[model samples]
Target: MEEFSPRILPLLWRRSVPARRAVGRPPRLSVDIVVTTAIRLADTEGLEAASMARVAAELSVATMSLYTYVPSRPELVDLMVDEVLWARGLTSDGTFRERVLLYAERTFAMYRAHPWLAEVPRARPPVGPGMLAEQEYVLAAVATLGLPVRELNRAAAGITTWVTSAARHEAESALLRRTTGLSSDEWWQQRGELWENWFDVGSHPTMTMIWNAGAFDRGADQQAQDAYEYGLGLLLAGIERSVEGDDRVP
Candidate 1:
């Protein structure tokens, strides 16, 4: 068995790939090019579609040539994830909550841009430089909240979890719409009627009451953008309470 080295595929930053031969003409291929092509393939199709052969085909190069720069598929995927995570723009200005919200929004937008990111498995801890930079940015934003190290780590994790899940849902909704040829409203409208026809409203009074109130229509599914904002607001409120040292439930 052999250990993995992080230096094998350094695609976290925008840099040219090492030339195949040390004393020859500039390398025609670069790691950045490979990773970018890989990301584009994943974005257009899905993660599974971004195979090394497919990426090499897109790059007009031989599959084995790619291995010269990128060690393997898993390494390439790691580079891709780090590259996108590095794209998140974090700011330390503004109040703590404001900074956190801005960071979360930017992170969410990044996930939406590269939805296939959710498909990547975290088999090991993130040891890439880009991931470390992101963690530092997040920790700095929440450092002033007067939280213990454990609580601070938990808060950051919670924020990332919420943003990732929300953005993944958004991406999935878009994919579903493309596959089904139906908008959210259209899909839900058909399902709403089925529920109306099949369910005994008399027995489920609470559900019936809410349904009659048009809550679901005006709720989470109607406008995902609004739903995201609403959820973010609630999450921010909870974070605010935690910051104020009132994290305990009533």
Candidate 2:
């Protein structure tokens, strides 16, 4: 067997894609044109629907023509995510909940609106301003804690990761639940009829109370709150703990 241990990789994965100030014959494509082309392709068709070739066609150019702009698929998607995210403006005036909630909801809405965007694998040293704005917003909310810049970075990253992961999980689980005619709720309800009855009233008193309460509403199903409030609240609470405890910034 041949041991092909390691290899060189494209700089796209290593360094930030350099910002281009020109488009067409001037030696670069306008970042807006490149990003907009990507967004239009992804939006009209789907994430999978957008490709360098397809985007070029959408732009009425040769497939090789796009190479003058985005270097690769990952780079293109990064551009598109950042481009589409620009619609979510950042506000600095709100309280902890308000500011943080704004970031979280914006992130969740973007990913939910483009489910495929949630699946991209990110690299260290984020490369887009839209994402950078999100981090800024999150840190601004926690600035009162007076944490070191590094700790603030961690808090902001937590908020970012929480929104992306939660939205992805929610979308996937909803799809799976729908595939089965009976949701997890219906399955759990039927569990009571099973012979082994793990949720029997005598064995599970708490569950019985929950079942009786009917907390799970199938139609008009609502989260305790939308993803923004839910995720933002969690991060704000975490910051509160850090502030109140020995975890103060160094």
Top TM-score hit: 1
Residue-wise lDDT of candidate 1 within 45-113, one digit each (tens)?
888888999999998999999999888887788888888877775656777777877777777787678
- CA-lDDT, candidates in order: 0.74, 0.63
Stretches of candidate 2 off by over 4 Å are: 1-31, 122-126, 147-150, 169-208, 218-221, 224-235, 245-250
Provide C-alpha RMSD values for all models, in order. Answer: 3.7, 6.0
Please provide, for model 2 over 29-95, each residue's C-alpha lDDT reduced to its tens digit, 9 standing for 90 to 100: 5446766777776655567767888888877788887876566666677666666565688776877
Candidate 2 clashing pairs? 22-28
Q: After superposition, how far is residue 72 of candidate 1 from its true place, in Å?
A: 1.7
| Model number with the top lDDT | 1
